[model samples]
Target: MKYEVVIGLEIHLELQTCSKLFCSCSTTFGKEPNTNCCPICLGLPGSLPAFNRRAIELAVTAALVLNSNVQLKSRFDRKNYFYPDLPKAYQISQYDQPLAKGGYLRIETDGNYRNIKLERVHLEEEAGKLIHSGESIIGSDYSLVDYNRAGIPLLEIVTAPDITCGREARLFLEDLRSILLYSGASDCRMEEGSLRCDANISLRPSGSDKLGTKAEVKNMNSFRSVELALNFEARRQAEILVAGGTITQETRHWDEEKKLTIPLRSKEGSSDYRYFPEPDLLPLILEDNLIKEISAALPELPAARRERLKEQFGLDSSEAALFTVNRSLGDFFEEAAGKYSDYKNLAKWVQGDLLYYLRESGKTVEEVDPQQFIELLALLDAGEINRPVAKDLLNEMILKGTSPQIMVQKKGLGRISGDEQLLPLVEKVIDENPGAVENYRQGKDKAIAFLVGRVLARSGGRADPGEVNQILKEKISRG
Candidate 1:
């Protein structure tokens, strides 16, 4: 019997705030361990918690963007747990009364769009970071905890079990990151621990509505790992069911290096947390006017902007998707499009050569100048420079941060189109490769291409390829 994979994602986003959620401690990353701690964050005695208004505004803004219905009143509860990383024996988070609920995000995969419903978007505080002496906590002889990240305002976005496969999960995450980045809520940097994800996956018999026993997978750092982990877990569960064995519902870790999942511990239910209302803090109340202001301030999200880009610029699906995810590249392309009418050519260069050079030179889109790139394209179109020269000039423009036109003028890297300069090179190529010339005379149409390549090579890629093609054909036909 075939199996169907069911996946639900729980993502944690660290809000971009200057201070901690309920304390005055610094929220800056890369600080010395234990240096950013304070009485409120360290949970020392005689300390009371205070809410951060900026954190609320940012979270509400994100909720509104995701189409969630922000509640008028939400309260915090104590989530009782004991771990070295969690200085506060209990974490202050939302339980039954969350900030918002009932939203949907549409994702596109293979040219088909589907809406992934959200379960809830609640606010909470982050736990501390654990440093192991070895590769991981399992094999390490000792572990250390740093409370610098503790008390930072965190948003937990939980999704309903709507995903069917690993690839879909990855696509949803990519689109979700783009939307969150556009909302200005979080940086969504996975490497920095600003954004993190844990997936609950299960496999059931095909065409059955009853869900199977799930194993929550953690330690997946990258989007690609998310895909691999979920797919691997699904197969593991399926193999168990196919045999006379049962899959144990437990928590697992994605060992990125081994590229497999390892059982961590038995999974915990909500009852295990022993949640209770916190007496210190009052219930969060948002006036209607504030919600209206936030809703009006919402900017264009990724999905709408992607469709608009396609319609406005006549870009195909893949090109539009590329621009939507890489907002800086889209901005550069749009600004250059204002000064240049060749939309197709501009898209090609931005998506193809520009991206390639950026990866090779360890440069970002911010370092590229829109005017310089357009000038390079314009030079190529006007026949002032050949393709090879234009590519080299583009590389220089990115690396040296100089204008392509200035570089061309300084280096005398103009097209060699004059017959006086090209004829001698072409004649030399003909004399050197007599076999190719003889083949051409014998009516071998492809032989002329080799002769042209020799002439272009002799000119150090500065020769006008079009002019060489014309001159070579004329010379060979006459001979």
Candidate 2:
């Protein structure tokens, strides 16, 4: 019997705040170990918690963007735990009263849109990082803890078990990351620990309403890893069920090298944390005006921007999706499109050659000057340069940050449009390939393309392709 995979994700996104949630310690990454710590964040005795206003605003903004209902009153509770990374032995988090709840993000899978419902979005303090001497904590002879990440504000987004497979989970995360980036809530950089996902996967009988035993999988540092780990976990659980073995509720660690999930320990429920309201802090009460103000001030999100790109610039869905994958890329297109009226050509070049060169040269869109790109397109549109020459100049411009006009002038890369200059090369190509000339003479018109290619190749990609094609056909027809 086939089994269905039920996957839910708990995403921990670090807020884009300069200071820790309750302390003034720097929230910057890549700092010296233990350097960005303070008494409040380190949980030393007599250090009381103080909430950061910016952190609250950001969290609320994120909730609004995700369509979550922000709570009027939310309180903090101490989540009791014992680990070296937890200096206070308890992490201050939300319990029954969270900041927001009941939100959904839409993801397109196989041409169908799925609404992945969310359980809650809560504000919490981040735990410190653990550095083990061995490959993992399982075999480490010694360990070290860095308190710098401690007390950093985190927004924990818990999704309902609405995902059906690994690909859907990845799609949801990609759309979610785009939304967060557009909202300026977090950088969503999985590499820097700004965004992290822990997946809970279980396998249930096909068409069963009841859920199966889930194992929490951790250590997924990228989107691809999340998809792979969940797929692996689903297969592992299914194998046990097929063999009539019982599935256990446990927490597993994803071994990247092994490409499998390893059983870590038994999973804990809500009671394991022993949560209790903290007496040091008061309950948060959001005013109506503040919520309205934040809602009104939200910039154009990804969805809205996508629609506008399609309507305003007449971009197709695929083209709009390509440009709006990231806000920066869409902004670059819009900026260049403003200077050039040919939206179709602008979109094609940006999506095709610009993206290709950016990936090939290890450069980013930000390094490219939009005006310079527009200049290149203008040169091509005006027949000053052919497509091949323009592509080469684009690659060079990306690598050297040079202007297209200057590159053309300095390197004599302009199009060879003059028939007088191109005739010798054309005659040479026809004489060298008598077969092509004979084929064209015998009414095989496609042979002219081969002869035209030869002519352009002789001109170092500077020859205007349209002019070469016309000139070749005229010469072949006369003979």
Which number leads on TM-score? 1
Candidate 1 lDDT, 1-479, residue by residue in tens = 88899999999999999999999899999999999999888888889999999999999998988878899999999999999999989899999999998798888778787999999999999999999999999989999999999999999999999899999999989888999999999999999999999999998889999988889999999999999999998888888999968889899999999999999999989899999998889999999999899888888888888889899899998898889889999999999999998899999999999999999999999988898899999999998888988999888898999898888899988887778989999999999999999998899989988888999999889897778999998987888
lDDT for predicted candidate 1 compared with the true structure = 0.92
lDDT of 2 by residue, 6-87 (tens): 9999999999999999999999999999999989998999999999999999999999999999999999999999999999
| Backbone clashes under 3 angstroms, per model | 0, 0
> How accurate locally, in lDDT, is each candidate?
0.92, 0.93
Candidate 1 Cα errors over 4 Å, as ranges: 427-447, 472-479
**Candidate 2 at residue 120, lDDT?**
95
What lDDT is reached at residue 417 by model 2? 72
Listed in order, each prediction's TM-score against the native is 0.94, 0.93
Give lDDT: candidate 2, residue 446: 88
In candidate 1, which residue pairs get closer than 3 Å at backbone N, Cα or C atoms, i.e. clash?
none
lDDT of 1 at 39: 89
